[model samples]
Target: MPDIREENKDIINCVLESMQGFVVTDLDGKIIFLNDRYADILQVDRHEVIGKDVIDVIPGTRMHIVARTGREEMGSLFKLKNGESVLVNRIPVRKNGKIIGVAAFGSLSMLDEMSTVATIQKIGHLSQELNQYKSELNKLRGAKYSLDQIIGNSPNLIKMKELIKKVAQTKSTVLITGETGTGKELVAHAIHQLSTRSHHSFGRLNCAAIPNDLLESELFGYEEGAFTGAKKGGKIGKFELANCGTLLLDEINQMPLYFQSKLLRVIQEKEIERVGGNKPIDIDVRLIFTTNRNLLDMVHQDSFREDLYYRINVMSIEVPPLRTRVDDIPFLVEHFISKINKELGLNITGIDDKVIELFQTYYWPGNIREMENTIERAANLALQGKLTLELFEHFLLRKEKERSRNENEICLETVRFKAEKETIIRVLAQTNANVSMAAKLLKINRSVLYEKIKKYDIRTM
Candidate 1:
């Protein structure tokens, strides 16, 4: 299991991440909010573009001109470094009838990836209330990360990276199996970045994050007004948007059996039909499926589709959990510390050998993600000098407490399930069986809350 926080981070990812790439600029045309898609398109990163001048980054751009004049510009064609041009529409953002910022939207009608275009219109129609209706837009939209991003020197990690590199050249569907926080998503990005379709869009859909009823429409898309609350002019699906690229299905084991058959059909046919449309649209996507559960065990239990399992298991890679690779802990800690130092603008030195020994001895059920979070937390508490065992007393003390708990807790999985059961039951009881209210109180999705209620066999009190 990964750190619960890292797992929950999926909740922040946008449903339509990277489909549209846009930039916002203050009145002076200083760049802000550059989506990962546009960063890829412009051949620049968010760090370079954000707070940067529009003309300095993209010379001859009329964004500054429009900003100063307080006028809107549409149908502006700009040539990218890749020689493919993007169609952009720039407009002024108003606050209390005064221009505060400029928003640029690329043409969704022309681009198969309509990710960013729909945002401005939604904001325009809803004003400040847009945030009230939707989840956060993907701050780190599915971008193609490379193998170099992975930090590990252990034998297992080296082998895993090599296997990923070898499999990336082929078009086979990949099934990445690992504990939560094992960098499965990062590996998927590395594979896509190394593949031939690296230049195209990369989109992801968390099977466990989305509600079952809406998963199909999100994956296959929908026709205009397909449903009662469907957005106008229809919307593009992840498959179509990532047609020439990759679509990572995170937590694939959680996909409902009802949709599994449809997914199998689309994968076999290499075409997708919108929820309400009759026409089948051809799509060429590199499918990468990830799971923290054993799909084979699920297949035996009849919870997962055998045919779909085999289809996705064409090339499988099992990543070793952090605890299993103790030799890599020091290197991983150093890497995380340096990265954290840069991120927080701190000059903290690496941990002492005694602290490293404790890290190596400790069991990390949350894997690398947990390690990073813990490192950051400990670093934040550090006052002066290298992080020592005393600085990590919070973790050291917790380990000691867990050691005492081990005899009573017995199986970790059982303890985890019981804890979850109790928490859900308590929240539901407090909410008087109102799923929405319970979910709000728990700060989780209502659908997710309902699922847990049923999973735990908790009756409404």
Candidate 2:
């Protein structure tokens, strides 16, 4: 029952509502009509400037210039005063041969959201590019962790450095043994840096962290469609990735016996076969293996292979834990503080001598890593140029108690081996169940500690 003209008007209004950023002007550059969407983009009311000069209504407008020329300025991009830019198409309206007006249309808003999406996609692409080049950068720099970065001046540390310098130029397979956090991985990098292969890539794999079934494929790579969800176009393995370079296999003892034979083949043959493919790919890689556990103990228990042990142990380095190198505490403290000064913009001159003395007294079971983090924490909270005992006292108490409690628990009862076993227990307690610390305090190798614990049926709990 609606009138035809009314229906047509309704349809036109509905279309205009959806036509975002639409405008109309006459030949003299006077505004005739403006849509609500266009007014929102211009940040003005649609009804307020119907008869105003288009240039006066919107500053920096070129529609008036186009009207004067009676020429089209199509596909022009315009920037707004509010820091938003839009793509616009300008068309000249004409009656017969005479030019009438100019019209323009484009996306004039929603630029902020669009720009943000574009930026995130660009960042993702850049991240992929950075990851692709990271290995080459590490090789060109010689080592990710250099000998200079180790941060200690103890005789024991100095001796370890000399050993590293001696073996770095040789082609012997190296086995780096140390307790957790003793910078064994850093030593690995230092070796690679001084090696003849320093110009090539450096690759690393952690045996303990990877799943047993996936470890082989990860090291040797696989062909496309080799298994479910295999990457398209195949993948390169770590050995291939480190061709003519150094490959660090960390937690070497954690590699399963099943895969140990396969690893031995790679070392002896200097070649690898892909997980799904049998073609042997030759490689020229220098091998460096690291273990926190005693591989000899694992071999004795039949968990690790003896032949593989002898092969990797062609050269070995056992870094003494920080507790055994108390003489280097001051140097380590200063080194860490100086490094933190650069990172945090702190000017911590030094810790008080009292704090340094306490630092030496406490058993650093976590070694240099623990010390670095502690210094970093204290530096973050420092008020002046010095770290006082007030801050040191809080961190020192728990470790100090461990030392005192072990000293107090002297088995007054004499039972020879039983008493010796009980003393070992006391040391273990004092060191807070850390095998490396207990061994250091008992003046024995960590392998010896494990053997005695097994012999005495000593429960660490």
* Candidate achieving the largest lDDT: 2
Top TM-score: which candidate number? 2
The per-residue C-alpha lDDT of model 1 at residue 447 equals 62
Task: Tell me how candidate 2 scores on lDDT.
Answer: 0.83
lDDT tens string, model 2, 1-461? Answer: 87999999999887766775667789888888888877877789889989899888777788876776566766455655465656666777889978888887664443458674475456556757876787668746346877788777778888999999999978889999999988899999999887768767889999999999999889999988889989998899989988988999999989999999999999899899997897999999999999999998888668999899999999999989989999988988888888898887888888889888888887787888988888887788884589987776558776777777666655443346787898988999998889998988888778878888998999987
Clashes of each: 4, 0
CA shift of 196, model 1, Å: 0.9
Give the alpha carbon lDDT tens digit for every residue of 425-459 in model 1.
88878878888888888887666676677888888
Query: What's the CA RMSD for each of the models?
Result: 22.9, 24.4
Give the clash total for candidate 1: 4
Lowest summed lDDT across 10 adjacent residues in model 2 is found at 406-415
lDDT of each: 0.82, 0.83
The list of candidate 2 runs beyond 4 A from truth reads: 1-136, 139-142, 404-461
